[model samples]
Target: MRNLWNLIVQYHIALVFLILQGIALTWFVGSHGYPRGKWVQRSLEWQGKWDQRMSQWDRLTELDDLNRELLAENATLRAELHTARRDGVQSTYQGAEVIRSTWNGASNPFVLNKGTAQGVKPGLGLLQNNRVVGRVVEVSENYALALPLINKSMEWSVRIGPTGPVARLVWEGGDVTRAMVYDVPRSASFAPGDSVVSSGFQGYFPSGLLIGKVADETPEFDGQFLTVPVTLAADFRAIRYVEIATVQGRMELDSLANSNGQQAP
Candidate 1:
């Protein structure tokens, strides 16, 4: 305590001088009109600049959100138009992001960020890049599970568009861009470049949903039918956005089909 008193005594003169100087400066500024005005002006200028910066920051944040919304809306519109022109059915489309997907396995599935809450349901057709991608197999309130066309367990009844045989679309356990169709009659016309689309006979997707084009044609191992290799129209390997094709009256159709043990006519 004595040592502290000694240090205080030592610096007392300097401290007193600083205090007096601060008081003199304050008095001089307050007593003068120009200095007081200058002080207030500078303070207001700094505050104005700060407010402007804050406003700009807010606008930038809003722009970021708006950009994302616009992109999503654009995807939905494009998909809707594409499906309407090709499918020729009473259907609507909703946009969704592929939150999870796998393409290198025997039974790959896709998880999307849309579900029942967004009007998504099982038996909904999924499309990407104007082509059939998959169908909704399961759903929750905010998400849905899909079986992409590349999955082994996924088989869609498709036919060669413009007078071709009805066959089955199946994955051969490899290749993301290619799959095969079986039961195509050997006598069916084999063109180098042929188009394939959904038959819509299974009541899952609308007809004329472009599946792919024939890449190659050859005889199956059993030698009874043609194993037609197809180049998929939709690229599932890097899909980011997808569209849900909600067929109108799906519930009634499903109920009737289930009751009859047959597809809806």
Candidate 2:
């Protein structure tokens, strides 16, 4: 303690001088308008920069939450539209993220981040951007598998328009952007630009859900029907988010059809 006191006594003069200097500088700045104004301006500038950086950080942190909210909103809107269609059943929707997908394969299957826990089940309809994407075929606790329209084995029941003829749309294992509509009657009147949509007969998507538009390719006559080429509206390669539609009473309807030894139209 005595040695510390001696050390303090030795440097006390310098400490006192430094303290006095600091006080003098403070007083000089306060008395001078120009110096004080410059100091205030610098302080404000530093504060503004710091605030901007903090705001950017906060936005970055909230981005994921914002995306989830958007997905929920979209699902609600879709459900409302489905109900408005009055397709003989009430429907609900849930949004999901596509974790994996394949477009260039014969049996193009995609995986979703939602499953039975989230009300996702087999035979549910998958939609993206208000257009039909696929149908859910399998499910686990937290994930589901779907077969897209690009799958060679997948055939969708689609119509040419709101009241047009219904035909089977199938992928012929070549182009990923196109599919062929078979069993279209030769008497059916449809142009190249007509919008093909779901017929709601397959028990997947409700009627009027857009599948694709008729392409400019010439229809090929196959005996009794005209096979038309269609340009698919959904881009399978870029699908990241989708909505799964669950039609109420669909299971009961399917069971009734099966009991009668027939398929649900």
Candidate 3:
């Protein structure tokens, strides 16, 4: 008790000043109505602002998770919208996050963080934003593999923009920057910037999904076909998230083509 008294004595003047200031503030707030009340209100307002700022700082840490969830929800809604427009026959789509990617000439495929648990299945069309990215080739209980359009063996039917001819879009194996569009009529008027889109003739993809833009066009010797170069819409090298399109009648179309020995345009 004596040591405590000596320590208080060392700062007695400071302690007295603090106590007097507190008493004065209380008296001013209690007795003075307008001016002191306004000051107190303003001080409380400042404290409230600080508290709000701290709350926002805490919420900032969840921004990424919020964005991802929003993206997934948006994809689901878009798929539902498409299904509605198709008279409820088109299969619903689901979103998936890419977990692994490989592109060393052994087939370019991506491993996604979705599988049967998420309604993901093999043969489902994969897309990014609004463009076709690939198709699901394999699926497990927890994950799936996607064969991206950049792979040398990948091919899809696509139509040129606004009445232009339809053709097969395929990667040429060596050039990653471009793909070859086959069977375009040499007489078809095409420019370097014409847009290409999914034909949806085979039911593997939705009509109007962007394929690429024409990069160049070369006429064959017989002047019957054009060797068209196309730049893909999806980067493939930097895809982070994707959606899988569950086509409802894709199997029927595939069986028909196999039986007839004909391909869809």
Q: Estimated TM-score per prediction?
A: 0.66, 0.74, 0.68
* Backbone clashes in model 3: 0
Tell me the tens digit of each residue's lDDT in model 3 across 1-265: 9999998999999999999999999885654322223443344345434544553554566774675687689788977788668743465677776766655553566667676778876778888888888887766656676788777656788888856777888886665667888898867787788888888775667777888898865534345777788988888777767888877877887898889898775
Q: Cα lDDT of all candidates, in order? A: 0.73, 0.79, 0.72
Measured by lDDT, the strongest candidate is 2
RMSD (Cα, Å) for all candidates, in order, is 23.3, 23.9, 23.8
| Model 3 accuracy (lDDT, Cα) | 0.72
Candidate 1 lDDT tens digits, 190-219: 664678888876666767779999886554
Q: How accurate is candidate 1 locally (lDDT)?
A: 0.73
TM-score of 3: 0.68
lDDT of 1 at 85: 74
Best first by TM-score, ranked: 2, 3, 1
